[model samples]
Target: MSTSLAAAPAATSRRRAPEPPKRTAAERWKRRGPLLPALLITILLTQLPLLGTLYYSLRSQNLLRPETNGFAGLSNYATVLGDEYFRAAVVNTLVLTASTVVLSMALGIAFAVLLDKKFLGRGVVRTLLITPFLVMPAAAALLWKHAMFNPLFGMLNWLLSVFGVDKIDWVSQFPMPSIVLMLTWQWTPFMMLIVLAGLQSQSTEILEAARVDGAGAWATFRRITLPHLRRFIELAILLGSIFVVQTFDPIFLITQGGPGQATTNLPFLIYQTTFRAFEVGEAAAAGVIVVVGTIVIATFALRVISSLFQEET
Candidate 1:
């Protein structure tokens, strides 16, 4: 009876658990205090610039001659909306943005798929692959325009000469394509990194499950991998579109917003308007529009994508 009672007490003790230690105030503050200050700083930094931009967007103050400036109630906005140049800029910007995003996503996915598999010299290939993205935009543009597409002494022309082909003017003949291709080359690695991250994050068990269901490789990708990567793909597009819309260096360096303003994007247009033409109010208005449009689109896309990830979880 004594042994039985001792064994019963031991079993009861095993069933009970010790209480977790309560956190002290200092410990709690240590964990969350830094985060609160960081969040406050982030909000202030972001909001202050936006508020200043909004203020400038409403005023007609030339940086060179502020004495002649005054408040313009929506006049700048009206002018920006009514101008043909602005309309063309909007279209060009959209096209460039779309082209960059689609091309980058496609090529990034292709390269990621290729790179995901083990291969010889993969390290060298990876380094070579990302070299273009790391090149300074100005240097890249200079090399493309002066050395690769200069019509006469350009490497592209020299290569074409092998087939008895004449040199073609890359910027003049295909202004938008040249800009699109250049930006695409520079930004695809951004997408590639995102896609590869997504691919690596995919659940191996889910893939095995698909394989056990007699799914082919294509079917497995369609049924499992793509679904899981929805969030990452959205991230790629979100970031890619924002940067593409604001592109300036390649267009400015390679084409100078021309062969007759053909390559003039929103950012380039803003620069030309404010710095070259001295239209400060109009340029600020343009900046405001670009910022608002970008924020709205990016926010909506991110929310949708975050919901997708949430649904899976």
Candidate 2:
């Protein structure tokens, strides 16, 4: 019996499938040729500008004083790193990104769960929920600034008056939170769409089996649904953070980076440095930093998405 079992393993090893033959150079080129134009265009549009930014970041350049432009080594980077306002902007960026992502994710999960259920007017509800995301960022910011947060004639102050509470200048008094709220409203729909896809993709049969096995709704969600949605949640948070960190429109429209520098973030700071301060070198350095940070987040997000796809396959 032992001899037969050993022989069986050897036979199985011999019967393993052979690898496919490699493609010829010409065949490979044929497959890749169709993508070359798009690839070249993308490089021209993205990589060239990035290289230009890096080149400028290494030198001292001021738009207002063009004659003083010359190589300054890493002085620009040092200046940006040492600037207190840059540090403050970094903190604001982190806080804004974290707050917006977390609040939107929570609201998204709730909305997704509600919409996932079979209910009357479900389609209409989903459509309405998704409208906020479809609205342009600039338009949405303006809408919130004028129609919602305006102290004199805004909906929020009017609502407060109904309860005899004093009118509050929301954007003036709470610049960061007001920005967070606007971002959350716009991005919650994006999160909801992703989470809703995950929810809908869940195996109903497994859920039914859990129910038959005496699992309650909360128990079923905790044990199975939550685990299944983990990847989706991660994806939503990563993507949301990546986008929210670059928030400029809402801040520009709603508070103009606040009554002070209260709402200034990395992007806004970069804008101020380039346009207002005319410190091109420092702004380029800051832009490079932001790009590097975004690339890191994007890399992790791509990995998570890849793993999710692999699991599905």
Candidate 3:
């Protein structure tokens, strides 16, 4: 009977398809212990605000109307979508983001290429070039607005005067262009830094081989350097667009969305809706839309940039 009982247990164990080995607590912790904490923290920080915003967006809460607040459903989204100002803000946001990112990336690539060569005072020059990006955004905007673009005593007008040209009101006369110029000035350095890193990491042997094959500077750059820099450029554009789309300090400090809402991007629009108009629900709805749009853009951008990691033919 004891033998039969032991055999029965063995048979049952075999028929059970041998349970997978149980991981030790230490092993399980080793696999996911570090990432679990960070993932939980990230979810807690990001999801909490998002949940609160979602709740707010679904309610008819307005600072102006204290007693009328209630469940509003999708009315806030409808209001925001139907508004002309929102539409204009969307367009302006697109233009501002596109222009700044493109110009900054172009100038950054140029500067990075030039700086990649061994030249006198290269360290000092690179440091000086990076100063603009390190400046606080509000301070940079203020510097441009008051010191560079002011029609009365700004340096730009003084320079124009030296050329026998009339002093022009920069912000009022060209609001969008003025904002673009300031943002480009500040962000180009950031893009340059990223591109320069990519340039320096390139294989020296590849460049030498291209030279040995009788490739001229332009040909080598067009075929070899440019291809290598493609991923960096895409990354720069992605990062630049993410930041530029949220431009607010420059608009607030320089143009104040003047010249009839010419410089108000989506972030500025959200600020206006929340504070100026006291429409909390609409602002939250706009925030949700912006988040959605950003996700959509980032999804496509990440896919494109992922191609850079594929084995090159």
Candidate number of the best lDDT:
2
Question: Considering every candidate listed, which one attains the maximal TM-score?
Answer: 2
lDDT of 3 at 66: 92
* CA lDDT of each prediction against the hidden true structure: 0.84, 0.91, 0.88
- The number of residue pairs in model 3 that clash at the backbone is 0
Local accuracy of candidate 3 as per-residue lDDT tens digits, 114-192: 8999999999999999999999999999999999999999998999999999989999988899899999999999999
Native-referenced Cα lDDT, model 1: 0.84
Q: Enumerate residue pairs that collide in model 2.
A: none
Q: What is the C-alpha lDDT profile of model 1 across 116-227, one tens digit per residue?
A: 7799998888788888899999999988998888887988779999999988888889989988888889988888888888898887888888888899999888878888
lDDT of 1 at 66: 74
Encode model 2's per-residue lDDT on 152-202: one tens digit a residue: 999989998999988889898888888899899999999999999999999
Worst 10 residues of 3 by lDDT: 9-18
- Model 1 TM-score, all chains together: 0.82
* Deviation (Å) of 175 in candidate 1: 1.4
